[model samples]
Target: MIGDAWLWVAVEWSPPSYGLPFTDQEFDTPTTVALVVAAVVKAAFLWLILRAPAPGPMDRRTKALRRLLYLTVAYDLVLWYPLALLLDTVVAAFDLALWTSLNVLFLLVIRWRSRALRATAGTMFALELAGMADALLDELDLPELGSNDAVGFVLALGGAAAIVLTVVGQRRDGRWSRGTLVAGWAFVGSFALMISVVALADMLFSGGLVEGIALDALGLVPAVWLAATARELPTDIGPADRPPARRRELRVAMAAVALLPIVALVHPEQSAHHSFTGASPPCYDQPHFGDLKPSERDAAFLCQARIRYSGVPPIFPDTLPDQAVLAYGRALCRAKDREEEREILTRAGSERPDSGMDPWDLVYVCPEVVGATRPELLRSAEEQKAANDAYIAEANARCRDPWPRTKGVAQATANYFLFVDGDPGYLVQDPGDKAAEQAAGLAMDRVYDDDTLIGVGGSAVLVGHVEDVSDLCLTVKAFRAAPPRRVAGWDYVNEVPIVSRSGQLTVPEMDGGDVGAGAPMPNLAIRGKGRYRLRVYVRADDSGEQHLVVVFPGASRKRLQLKP
Candidate 1:
């Protein structure tokens, strides 16, 4: 009952911006049915967690195991609640409070003779509630006692211990139902199997994609199996859901459980989202990645995968699962830059109402976790969308009417290089190699995501003006059959390879470093959409006269030649 109810909770929670289909769980629109279900489930969870084992032959052994589970759960619950409250995870605090209240009530109501059993049972109830709460935290990204391997191992061991207690009790009572046995063993099997695969994903770091799927399958199958078994379980069941001792089918079930690991091994190495786990401890004072179940980690990354800065600077080697918010802020909004950046950083420091923290944190942790402290360093969801959308619209307009606009030539000292794609167009072609993508030829595109070969896989040039870059106007015009001869007047200097996938090239493709407070250039492109041997030329100081012109088509062309 608790499992089924908790599953509903997972389905209902929806975080802001990354909300699920449903916007709220029980809180926002707490219907009578929801309230009723919540109360009953909470009660059921409490009862199951706290109730001590029925008096039986193995009571002593089972009692010892439950004690271990209880003590650990109690210790962690005490530590987790304050953080949960600060983070607005009221649900977590409520759970701890209810568990405490129940423990107090049980101690008072039960006779002193049975006080030991009641306390034991109360601890058990807390564990079950913790499991239910975990489902919510995973779905909602709430801060709490995170689900990790140690917890999983303990849970599986608990399940195994439950099976033993059930079997001993059922045989002693002589009415072990087959359904109970099957369900109990299956729980132990699936629980252990799921936990084992998660451990493997952790140990085999890069296999996230394949291993992640297997882990999900392992989690879901067990949930369903337990639900069905619980619904059909007979009267004698239940403290541990033990099955009959003499059933021959028991061997088959255990054997099946033994074979389950193979399924995980055969799947792809990791979860689909990351295809690999991000390094643990991605930063200081951060939770370890292991705290989240593999699926939860994948989901969390998916929620935060948007790259804020146009290009992530290479300095911060951090990867996904790190503070998704502050990813590029350190690179994009450093205070050491021109006055614009420095002023913003300084202003943010003065404005931050917090006691005292790194003012630069405003940039580093964009979409700050605690709240939207991003004054300007980071783009709020609204700003990010607006900026990207605006960029796309302008880019589209240019790609359509691509004639070189009559803008003043970038002064003699242009950016480091005006990299154009077509390297693969004139070189080898391999999709996996970031360098060889242009071989696929240019395909016009409207959408780009560092994927789409048409947008990626190209070449670059050390575009220069005389000593720096001889830009009368650096341009390329496509020639289907062949281009015209090199225009006269300009002296041909050297030949360099070029690749234009999407048949588009942009000028002053600044390396960013050399790009001073120059003209705020559009991040769009020029229309040289294919491979070419761009013949470099320089017009002698014709006294800066002759209306400097860099013409194409009047230039020779040939079908892209790939190096053998």
Candidate 2:
């Protein structure tokens, strides 16, 4: 019941991301609305549970079923009230970490003897797995181990163990009754269908509220299917004296039903994957890619050209792979594609969405992670400290002096200033930023509520309301102190914390281009990059917009860091 949307409406709340990455992109209108709709859906779930037919009698199996059903429903409805009441107004994020902890608790029933409960629990576990399906699939597809490989491997094993135990427990309980078989099939089968349907839906759509609702609506199918079929589920094993003759037929039918979703989901996803990465027609999709080429039999395929490539007419090189790893110790930008590594020409898919790892992680001093291929790659981690120092030192040699510096924050204008990466190369060549397209023409509250306007990934558009597609100049500033409650002759737009660890601010993501006001490094000289506060103040004049930001020092607290 309590999420950013509800709280924003209730208390005018906003996410504390400021200009930092990760925490940005949250509490958005679509997210909030989806949460609201989910709360309503969960409430509807409770009602539907009540509406579900009452149990036939009280057996160990029936008791176990009700135990889980009632207890989970209770916890789902009740667990958040205290958190919202006592803690700050941020909803606990929904991600792998939270899901792992919650599902791990279900292992308590591993010792229980009810096959029906195990089946249901196994089915419930599917909920989290479905959320993580693409991530798991992507990790499974990795040519070599990526950062999250361990977590993914462990979770896969843990979930498999829990499910296996359920099947083992069922086997130990007498021979399989037809009723037991039906119930087991129903529980597991429905979830299998749900996983495929939901995951495929994700691959197909990004229309925020509509996509979310459509996914949730698909969930009702499996849930209601399980409930409707619940009466036939008998936890007790063993055959009746006059068992039906056509047992094999029933098994095949359930197997077919369970496999239906997998086929439905994977076919489209694999097709889209081929379409996007290989520059094939994005089968079963509306137009998003640009370079559409005619394929066999009048079919069309689309190719991608990166926004940040340096070229005349031809934008991207074919060798530019989809992902890269900046091995700082080796001082190399290694392509993630195994084919690229072996000099075998092939294409790979983009980084999976909702995966915690970014396409570029901590990438201020590195070259284009995707495009570059270094002969000297995969060096030792021990060189990391020395390599970073040498890299920065070399950058210092290759840079110009007195990168853009501005002071005295607190302004009264309409320009929304931003914080971005300050790579020595970027400092020397201040290419313009492509601030988030979604943030354009929105209110200040909407910007802070939705984006980490104060932080830098690749310089994104600072959220500002505008009339037409007119061009504007942007500026950057850093602070080491907190802004005073009331500042002199300036209207406060927003303020949030920014932390610097390597004694440098990140440059916004950009390739070579002449931005009106190139994103130059701000000369905020200090001992090293440490945690600091950034206060954003704006004013609207055609005067280069240099003083759009101010920096304050020292932050009291750091907000939660969300991950996949």
Candidate 3:
């Protein structure tokens, strides 16, 4: 029942923006349910602590563990009440600090209980502390001392060794009481169970529901068992003070319990998020961007793009004249000055000697002047109507609808799609290595060459870790041939590049691969015999008084052969 309830809590949690969807508190049903569950867990913890047998004369470890229990209950109470209810930066910091302290205290108790368990707990605890330091560095914008993955690897190896030692030692020595054994095992087992459930659940769901519920259950069950079972052997007169018989069953149970920590330590990498260090590669100067999850990349992209295009001094010093012209044209269109918009745009088109600006881009800049002077721009009134409707449909789909836009860009473009998060500030392309180039070209060609090929692949650039929002823009581009029309379409429409607005691309979490999780793009379509070229551009817009920024690498005109 507890486990299932935990799953519900996970589903209903108001996790941070990076974790999952549905972060708004307006949908308070799940939070309310979680609160109820938390209350139950807290009550159980308190009951166990209060009802447990008091420590006898010289059970120092027992006394220490009892004190830890009281502290834990206090911490949980704080988490349950006003602290949990009020979410703020300070609250988050307090929560993190309390959580770390609790874990550390628990480890100290384990170390105090038995010399055999000490080494195991000590090693893991030390690693945990280091991981915490790394996390702290990331949070404070300090250089990372080491990678979390490395720390996890070491912890896993050491934990496996510890487990073997503990089980072997238990099998040989039987001095521990059944109650003590239960408490000891429960100490490790509960934490392991929570960790395992959370890791497995992450695989199945993006939301934090599964993990949250399990955490509550984990926090209570073992503590209850410990309190109920805690009974020190009486140390009184003569023979009465002798220890209880060591049971074979209890030893076996201890052995089984020893296995639990191994499970917890198995995949330490996943725990990296809980750790202090940012998981981003050491290449990027700033840890801020590295901390952001792929789900929240859209917002990061928009924030960065706006800065780059603002023509702010020292950031983007040289604004392209063409981009400036396009920005002006867009402003004129917005102000309902269609005549001036057309004249300026038309004159700009005629006079600007091979301006990098494309006709399709100009249309977006001045959509109101669609029919006045550019009759050739649309095939007919019906085509114009379709285009206008498509424009509206695209806007509505991007603004209001969820994934898989109204007319899937992937489908409309015959799988060729391009979604860019404008641009941050810099540019660097793949300096073609023969082996890598051949591989990328072959991958692209294979899809275009074979009729049996339904899947497509393209080149990806994972430029290590980005520090600030300004460090990078999420760019995803795919090109498709314009649908054949009787009237000449806008020149750039032949290779229409669609840009993804903020909050559009929701790729899976990056695994710290070489490509570093580039923005996702649609598949490249191969329908006709003509060879294709890929290009990228930077453009600016004036959308609702915000300076628009679009900086992207142009695709190489190096044509990929259609034939195999």
Each prediction's TM-score against the native?
0.30, 0.24, 0.31
- Kindly report which residue stretches of model 3 are placed more than 4 angstroms away from their true locations once superposed: 1-46, 52-55, 58-65, 77-81, 85-120, 143-177, 202-215, 225-564
Alpha-carbon runs more than 4 Å astray in model 2? 1-243, 268-564
Root-mean-square deviation (CA) per prediction:
18.8, 23.4, 22.8
Candidate 1: tens digits of C-alpha lDDT, residues 253-312: 433333332232222322212322223223323222334443343333322322223343
Report the C-alpha lDDT of model 2 over 1-564, residue by residue, as the tens digit: 234434434321223332113443455566566556655665555455455444344445345554554444443345444445542212322233344433443333223355465445555454334434435344333222123656545545445444444445444444334443444444454455554555587576665444544444344433433343233234332343223675355334433333332233333322222212323332343221122221211122123222221332212233343232112211222435433433311112222211222223212223244225431222323444356446444533432211233343321112222233321111211122133232222222234454333332221223332212232233454444443434443333555454444454323322233222233344331335455544444333443222344444565444322210
Model 2 lDDT, full chain set: 0.36
In model 3, the Cα lDDT at residue 434 comes to 32
Best by TM-score: 3
Candidate 3 per-residue lDDT over residues 1-564, each given as its tens digit: 344344444443432443334543333456457656766666655665566454446354446555554555555534455665553444545544553453443332232335446445545544544444444445433345455667655644444444333333332334334554555566556656655665576575446444454465566655454344333322220221213463344334443343343233333332222211112122222113224443333333222212322223211112223234435445444544445545554444433222223333334334346435665453444565566556444532332111122232241211111123522222111223234444334444443342322112233111111122322223333224322222221111111121221212112212322122222333332222222233222212221111111112233433222222
What lDDT score is found at residue 512 in candidate 2?
A: 30
Q: Ten residues in a row with the worst lDDT in model 1?
A: 422-431
